[model samples]
Target: MPRFSSDGVDIAYFDEGAGDPVLLIHGFASTKEINWVNPSWTKTLLGAGYRVIGFDHRGHGASQKLYDPELYHTRLMAEDACNLLAHLGLPRADVIGYSMGARVGAQMALLFPQAVRSLVMGGLGIHLVDGVGLPQTVADALEAPSLDDVPDAMGRTFRAFADANKADLKALAACIRGSRQVLSREEVGRIFQPVLVAIGTRDSVSGAAAPLVELLPDGTQLDIPNREHNPAVGDKVFKEGALAFLKARP
Candidate 1:
């Protein structure tokens, strides 16, 4: 684990394997290991001859914690990714992001398009425009004194997951708050890079795939049949679809 200065916060990241670079951004309440390693994402990318890069966003994983909601904006997280690339001396790289990470990836393509060669946005769909899947209730759960205090099922599940991960609850609360910011349809359409939007057929949080794909200049969707958000993270369909898209990029 290495640390770097991103917008004044010390962010932790991993750079492994070798070849064309592929940056991996994990989802909400997830670290690089949980999102990439446990799911074999690093293995998949490395086997495809890609240099894998991953990092903990502010307030998540081993990164510096920030309790301010203003600091948790996905745009700021996107900047952290760009800065990580700058730190690695990579002008551009293929990018993959799941759940919360997908929003950050979309922001990266929107705000720093030159730094993204191609984009794979997973665990996300029309939610990019319709508003974040989870409501303010999830944020409230993170701020609750204990998981038991979270009445909402989805909120409780996220709170428990955060607890299991030993996450900074207050910081994560802020993350959930600030991360609710959404990209407009016009903004999403502006991300002209070849994009693959992967989501599970059974995933309700991600919303519909067709609406998102309709906005991008070069976007396609891959639905993992009978899968949901959590289980779809490392699905072979997702990995294979992503690898194929990357290979097809000129």
Candidate 2:
């Protein structure tokens, strides 16, 4: 329940355990509790002898909500993360980002490289370069009067998740629209840090991992078997691969 100001926006976060710090950024419409704590990611990393830092993005979780779509850019969110590191006086930390967070983490490594020692991008892949994330229809779904009004399959699913999360639909609607900035191949190619891209084999959202891996100077891919995007979060194989990657990262 701790908080910090990222350019005046209140960002809620939790810091626990002790060792190399690992910053955990959640996916769109997911809070830190929903994305990291409830999934036992905090437990997994803490058990692995690492300090865990998990934060709610600006429009999600216990953080302040802004209705302006312009306010939710990943660059600004990425700065929120770097500001958290600065708040704790840590020069750098290993980062693990899921879905939307992976995009933010990539921006972090690109714009604030000094704050990221290494990075693990989960539930996102080649789409990082090829796609802008989620879709405009997702924002439309959020703005829909009710879930039944949403027609897109993925949009309906996201609407349900957002409702279940008790999120501010207005704020999240803007987020889904504003945060879809895609990183170009050249932009991604510039992320010169040890990296791991883990995506579910069945995940239609993340595209493919190997193609994205090909762009990184030091990147590896992990295909989570028999899983899709959401299910892949707490997958045992995904955790094992991530831990292995984190341990071996310099």
Candidate 3:
């Protein structure tokens, strides 16, 4: 693992393999390893002859931890990604992001359009406009003394995932709070890059892929059979569809 300063915060990251770059952004309550490496995403991309770059967002993994909700805005996280690319001397790259990572990736496509060649919005769909999927209580769950104290089902799930990752609770709480901004249809439509919206058939959190796909000027959809938000991240269908999209995209 390597570390770099993004603006002022130190971010932990890994740059592996070789070929055209593919930035992998993990989900909320997830790290690069859990979201990408452990799921064989890095392996899959690398095997396809693509370079892989991944990092722990400021409040997650081994990156600098911040407690300010204001600092965790998705745009800021998107900036962090841009900075990572600038740091690596990459003007642009393909992006594959899941859940919160998907939102961050979309922001990158919007704010740094020239820096994103194409995008795969996995585990996210119409929710990009509707709002980030988790209930606000998931943030409250991060504040609970123990997982047992989180009575909300979704809250407990996130809390347990954070605890398992040995995450900084206060930093993640702020991230959940600050990263809730939504992109309007107008905003999403402004994204000019080719986009792939991949969601699970069983994903209630991501809304449907069609509506969001319809919003992108050049968007397509891939539905993972019998999958939910979390499980869909590692699905074979997702990997194949993503690889195929990458191959077909200009």
- Per-model TM against the reference: 0.98, 0.98, 0.98
lDDT (0 to 1) per candidate: 0.93, 0.93, 0.93
Relative to the true structure, candidate 1 has a C-alpha RMSD (angstroms) of 0.8
Candidate 3: misplaced stretches above 4 Å? none
Candidate 3 per-residue lDDT over residues 26-99, each given as its tens digit: 88878998999998999999999999999998899889999999999999999999999999999999999999
Query: Looking at model 1, how many pairs of residues clash?
Result: 0
Q: Which run of 10 residues does model 3 get worst, by summed lDDT?
A: 127-136
Candidate 2 off by > 4 Å: none
| lDDT tens digits by residue: candidate 1, 171-237 | 8888888888789999988999999999999998898889999999999989898999999998999
Worst lDDT 10-window in candidate 1: 130-139
- Angstrom error of the Cα, residue 1, model 3: value is 1.4
CA displacement after TM-score superposition, residue 124 of candidate 3 (Å): 0.8
Clashing pairs in 3: none
